[model samples]
Target: MKALSYLILIPTDPIYVPTEEQAETGADALEALMPAAEEVTYDMFDDVRFIDGGQAFEAITCPLCGKDAQAWWHNAMDKAAEAEFEELECTATCCGGQTSLNALIYQPAAAFTRFTLVATNAGVGGLNETDLTAIGVPLGCKLRVVTQSI
Candidate 1:
């Protein structure tokens, strides 16, 4: 099934992974940090995932129609693996508008301590050094951030 999520991932798990309780604690910290955001969830690194989600569309919007890109995603799926785009520039099939994959808007697809924290309507921005440090204090380590769309 298709899901719309923005994933925040770790570059590597620590030598000793946190317990679910630890994960929950970390998630709660994040919740406090991003109170406007949706609940945070976790996913342990069971499968290898991209550190940087290259070519992924943060959102699919046609410049012309100003509508969801899914509206014109007629043949895009078939070309996915073949195109292997780190970024794309094309014309929409629906309104024939220009299309370009750009910055992530929302929908988290993360593996947060094996939990989830999605803010579909809230805004997410880069975590500064201070913020990262705060988040790490509870988890006892720094978390590398990667943005991925699903």
Candidate 2:
């Protein structure tokens, strides 16, 4: 049977910005825009998991003796610094090998804000689009899956 896992990141602080009119008028218009100013709310999502496709396999043969060699699989998650993010690693039980996957979440300290998600896949085979999408973002958040392997 195949297994799947999900991880979610939530912002602990509230997101606020100046009104459209105030932004156009400049800082001097703060007073006028204060009354009509609005707050932006970012909702958090629950983590969910589903059946992932079966593992990918590769045949290995020993060149010296011309014999078959043992093989294994691995998977994991790693988070970047800031917001006290933590890394989580999981290995395949049957394979006895491990892969450390890292999920880095970084936000700028400047006026403009940005978010980035990166993953590292270190194994013989790769993960499918559906599986990466399922694991990367929250259930409802706008998350685009961008994946590459080495």
Candidate 3:
């Protein structure tokens, strides 16, 4: 089977949001930190497969309030909930300050092949966690680690 991989880049800090506005102007500082993937094309004869290696943040701080916000690594299949994935708590000395930060790498199972196929299809739009789960990816949910560095 031909294995496919996607490198999704997300901010270690929740303060940043990826959007079209950032994609334009060609000068968004956040663009430097966004994730990138190599180009690949699958032909009709190719077998579809997926390899998990995406990263997610543990904690992000508010630039103004400096309050810490926890991070999560959710499986596409897992339902969204208040306490579904991992959570990082504030540890900074400052009152209400947040310090913990984490990044997670998710690997999809064999079932993820369906999602990959959709993502690769020319008629299909794109694939998000929800789309991945809708197809049949396993639920290996939750943040697995916590650390200062991303």
Q: Pick the candidate with the highest lDDT.
A: 1
Q: lDDT at 54 for candidate 1? A: 42
Q: What are the candidates' C-alpha RMSDs?
A: 10.4, 17.4, 15.3
Worst 10 residues of 2 by lDDT: 104-113
Weakest lDDT window of 10 consecutive positions for candidate 3: 141-150
Show pairs that collide, candidate 3: 9-35, 52-107, 56-104, 58-102
Each candidate's TM vs. the true structure?
0.47, 0.17, 0.25
- Expressed as tens digits, the lDDT of each residue in 35-142 for candidate 1 is 775546666554322233344445555556666766445455335324553224456676766654322111232212322223332357556778666766666666
Model 3 regions more than 4 Å off = 24-87, 90-150
Model 1: CA > 4 A from native = 1-16, 54-121
What's the distance in Å from true for residue 137, model 1? 2.0
In candidate 3, what are the lDDT values of residues 10-114, reduced to their tens digit?
Answer: 223322222333223111221222224233221121222222333443444443345542332232223222332233332333344443322212222111121
**lDDT-better candidate, 2 vs 3:** 3
**Rank list by TM-score:** 1, 3, 2
Q: Global lDDT for candidate 1?
A: 0.49
